[model samples]
Target: MAKIFSSSLGGSLFKDERFLYQEFVPERLPFRDEEISELVFCLKPASEGKRPTNVFVFGKPGTGKTVSLKFVLSELEEFSDRAKCLYINCFEYSSKQSIISKITNFLGYAVPSRGISYAELFSKFVAVLRTKKVLPVIVFDEAEQLLKSEETKSLLYDLARLPEQQKLSIGLAFISNDNFFLSQIDDRIRSSLQCSSIPFESYSPSELKEILRERAKYAFNEFALDEDVVPLCAAHAAKLGGDARIAIDVLLKAGRLASREGAKKVLVKHVRASFTQEKPVKVEVTSNLSEQERSILDLLKKKKSQDSGAIYDTLKDKFAERTLRAALAELEEKKLIVSEKEIKGRGFTRIVKLAGS
Candidate 1:
């Protein structure tokens, strides 16, 4: 009988594959020292048992916003017992109730997931915070997910007013790819936030190289990557959008491809081959869009093009006009769709179509 598995094995390419994952935070984040310093400056007050300035961090994806803030949060919690940090992905906890529940749970309270009104849960959280008297610094990543509806918007309002209304000193940080995220919020809420802003620029090819080289050190074994592999991956990702995530993804895929072929090293050809196998940057961007944005894109895909009014009418049953307009503007900003002014019978209307259609 044939053996179930071959006795011989080739040299594996990866030393520790987890280093390539998005969730893995490195000990040192390359090319983001200035940003990290600014985060520390903004959040330092919490370590002194004071209300830290709320911060709004904006950047194109893969520019190190989330990871930098996370690193600082970890350091803050480690440095001082006065500060407690909680990180929440707004995409996963998009609702107001869910966010409050998470905070409650993080504060060592295990509230039931269901059978509690948002008001009750929120009050319980406030009570917990007041009793604990610890300054909580909450980081909301992908914050645009919280702007989809008025209900969720109220959550931001309440959070911003926590100090004034509940007398709790809390620090809030929002990370998003959208620069115009604040414009959609109510003026009162926006004023209450008074958040300091930090913008992260897209990584240049050289910058991406440094990032890839650092990640590769832990992700792959010695001599596992050919001389040109890192440069090739960086150049490709730079051309695509200067996204470090894409560059790392390409590197990981190339390593896997080399291992699959029993090749000792990941070569330029392996990187090139992985380009077709890896998902395009647009797909990655689309996967991160909110449900409303995805629905709008799907509609555009089917209709090819539609006027503002028509698109609104078709989707009005599911979303309000305000929500639709915001989602459309966001899609255009993301370059997922294109909008043009066209002449109607009486006046001009905007024509919306999928980008590159």
Candidate 2:
């Protein structure tokens, strides 16, 4: 009994932080009031049993494309009972059969384990909707992946053509990571979709700061995040293409690092440590010399100084019999190594050495 009580107490003490890293996304969609108003108008009872608007929402990752479409759908559902809404992440269901099966499953239909093709599944889905007299709004998230696959793209084309062909009211929302997703499609497929395109842009530093601040309030107690930490995180994220996901990841990592160290509040030191620890391999390679580059530098240290051609030949002989010329140029560009132009017998030879050496 005592051991059970101790285990329960330990579990309670290690509770997860309640703060949300992503803010209330519904409020941050840039210049989307016109789009929101149009969607709301489409959900009116007068438009019941009629088709909802077909929308194509595209943007770079972490630009709130999925969140905005989801926000609008949630609001529309609340405002009207005539509309039925479903959202599917296409990354999980990249194939046509898988997507159709998920749709049927979401609508409370029993998905057959096998022997059901995508076309048959879609037919049942449309039949159920027509019989129920409900205008169904289906959203495909990460839709660029679907557009890239021929079978999935053909399924979407057929679905979009349904209303015109069978006189059934069905609306589609395609959420992609870029505008080029549409351009990559067949013209006939593109024309059949004929959607009103909505563009989502990456957040600015100030915008990202505001978003982080709002999220911090929910994720941590007041005064937990230092004033400078939010701005620093925002700047870091802005430098990496204004990725909100990265901003939130940095915030979470910093906060956890602070907590693990038993600090009263998050600080720049903790943020820096977390950034360094979680840094990607490519970024780390640029930050710290990779194993191969370190080996090259060690070899360079053996010689007083060497020209590019000589270094390349030496590395090819010593290492994997591969040239080191490209690595030399990159290191020179990074200022990790220095290059000198010296007059040889004829043309100038560029000698390379460690930056300080």
Local distance difference test, each candidate? 0.88, 0.70
TM-score of each: 0.80, 0.71
Which pairs in model 2 have colliding backbones? 19-218, 19-219, 20-219
Alpha-carbon runs more than 4 Å astray in model 1: 1-10, 279-357
Runs in model 2 lying further than 4 Å from the true structure: 1-47, 280-357
Q: For model 2, what is the alpha-carbon lDDT of residue 242?
A: 66
Backbone clash count, each prediction separately:
0, 3
Structure candidate 1, residue pairs in collision: none
lDDT of 2 by residue, 191-230 (tens): 8777777777777899888877766766677777778999
Q: How does candidate 1 fare on TM-score?
A: 0.80
